[model samples]
Target chain A: MLAQGLTITISVLIASAFFGYLFAFIAGLCRLSKNVILRKFTGFYVEIFRGTSLIVQLFWLYYAVPMLFGIELGSNWWVGVIAIALNYGAYMSEIVRGSILAVAKGQTEAATALNMSRFQRMRLVIFPQAVRMMLPEFGNYLIQMLKATSLVSLIGMHDILYYGDILRSSNLSQAPTVYLLVLVFYFILALPLIFLTRKMEDISKKGVASQ
Target chain B: MIEPIVTFNDVHKSFGDVKVLKGIDLDIKPAEKVAIIGPSGSGKTTIIRMLMTLEQPTSGDIIVDGKNLWKMEKKGSMVDANEKHLRNVRGDIGMVFQHFNLFPHMTILENCMTAPIHVKNEDKSTAKQRSIEMLEKVGLGDKLDNYPSQLSGGQKQRVAMARALVMRPKVMLFDEVTSALDPELVGEVLEVIRDIAKEGEMAMILVTHEMDFALDVADKVLFLDEGVIAEQGTASEVIEHSTNERLQSFLHRFRS
Candidate 1:
């Protein structure tokens, strides 16, 4: 039961993070783009996701959305993935936009003077430096997204907390043992993520230092 | 007679109500070195910036290499140059800033190679070879692999000069290139500029506070005051023999 729950949690975490990063980058670029329509659309998306509660968003996606649209959204799994991704992605988009803007204006001017096209300037010159600034904040968002995945259990997805609740109910007399074991499992999962963030921070710092 | 490489036709620039440049007309022949000198905010730097298309004129035109820089042919009409048109013409011009704006993430070699490779579509090998040659010319060949953070201000400025030169720009604009450097370190960067001035056929416009160096290196000097050229002549004539009261007072402020 624990293994199945861990599998579900890890899968949702990885999938949401992947999709969320893509969404954040696209939303961030749209926010920065000169096109008014794209800017407004992405701005709306960000505000809608970020302004609402994550649980409300999850419940809406899982229940209200399908009913309103009269369309089946495959499974609770898909709903969980989309909800967590869109919620976290909206928050992360601000981080992405801020980091990109934080890259020195002089860098852009230098690239412009060199006659680098806008694409070349962003890809080769600006983004590399901006990525360095984004990584630490992104790591924090990753952890936040991990914790937010627990909300998926409310939507009837069999994530770790859902199974932990089940274990608590079945063995009410020995509930402490079950809850403690569940806590250990979560700590075990979180340890590597925290470690990975640190490792990435070190690598990026070293890259800058070596350069 | 050889055509002038750069022409400013009654150029006027203003920022809101603040007028910066007023009815300026100038022509720069190929291989000519013109030094612009004035007190701060006299619009010395603005002239170089306008020529580089970093700033646009409020009225009139800047023509470089027989093409109008501020206006571009679109369909049948002349329109303000867009980013594409600006990029198209920007290749002929290069600028070195007071602050050496080297891409800090890149090595000195990469800094020199980036523009040529991306803008000119030169292959990596040829770009690398030319970057090495340019870096060597700037006396930074040994520091090619070093980042801008690792270089001194003088070295970084030299690398910047080399980076600009690697593109073989038809016109070079130096905006107080040594003003940010240590007084002791100014000579090395100026030495590199002097060498380029002697060797290249590029038209050079220098906005410098280094009056002696300007007089030494520039073929012509323009003394700007209150957004107009108060005095203009040969380097020695303007620097040494100017009778214009505004220029005399401006020069007096710098001399002692």
Candidate 2:
């Protein structure tokens, strides 16, 4: 039973992290764009998603939005994924913006003097250097998104915590054992993420050193 | 009677009431080398920056190769040049910075090849061949695969010169190119620049504190003071025999 719950939790974490990364980059670039409309739109999206509660957002998507559209989502899984992606994406956009800005002004001027188009300059020169600065913050956001997935249990998704709750109710005498095992399981899942973050940090540092 | 390669007509620049360049006018003929010398805040670097379109002039025209740089034709009326127009006009010019701002993430060869392949749309093989040749010319042929961080100040500046030359610009601007180098390294970078000037087809504008190098390589020298050309003449006349009080004092500091 715990095995089934762990599978669902891991899947949601992976999917949300991927989608969040994509959204973060798009929103980050939009925020930095010269077009006032795009910049304003991204600003509004980031503030709305980041300012509000994530659980409320999940509830709105799962319960209210589908009803308004007159379509049945049948499961809250999609809503859980979407809410996690958007909320974390909003937070990560600021990280992306800050890292991009931190790149030296001389890099941009050098690209301009070379007569490169704006897009070419960003892709070839600026983004490559900026990504090095973004990696550590991005790793932290990924792990935070993993922990936040436990909130999906409130909407009836059978993630890890949900399974632990079921076990406690089914065998109340073993409630301590069930809860303790669940804690161990969460630790097991989180430890590897932290280890991977360290590994990625080392690799990125080496990459920059070689450069 | 060849046309001047660059023209600055009554150019004025200011930063919120602090005027840096005040009504400056000058012409740079093809294959001519002009050195601009001045005190620290006298706007020597501003002229190079404006020519490269890194900064805009407040009010006047900068014409490069007959096209007004800060202004463009819009429905037959002259209007301010937009980014697109600026990029088009920027193709014939290149600049080397005091800091040798080579892309730190790329190898020297990649740095030299990037602008030519991406901006000029040269084929990969041709760009690579040209880049290798230019790197050799700048005396960095052995260091082509090395990153900018691995190179010394002088080597990095040479790579910068090679990177700009690979684009084959008709006009080059050097903004205190040797200022950031150590005294021992300054000679190698200046030697490379002297070779580029002697090759003699591209118009060059150099802003430098090396008065002797300026005298050796510059065809003409303009002494700028208080945001205007205080004196202008051949290298010997301006550097050695200037009568202006501001220029004489300025050169005296460099002499000792």
Which stretches of model 2 miss by more than 4 angstroms? A67-74, A203-211
lDDT of 1 by residue, B104-129 (tens): 88999999999999899999999999
What TM-score, to 2 decimals, does candidate 2 have? 0.95
The TM-scores, chain A only, for the candidates as listed are: 0.94, 0.92
lDDT of 2 by residue, A1-211 (tens): 7767998789889989999999999999899999999999999999999999998888888889878998866567778888999999999999888878877888888899999999898998889888887787888888899888999999998999999999999999999999888878877898988988887687556323211
What digit string (tens of lDDT, one per residue) describes model 1 on residues A76-186?
888989998998899999988988887777677778778889899999888988888788778878888888888888989898889989988988987888888877888
Candidate 2 DockQ vs. native: 0.60
Question: Tens digits of per-residue lDDT for model 2 on B73-125?
Answer: 89999888998999999999999999888888789999999989889899999
Task: Record all residue pairs in model 1 with backbone atoms less than 3 Å apart, i.e. clashing.
Answer: none
lDDT comparing candidate 2 with the true structure: 0.90
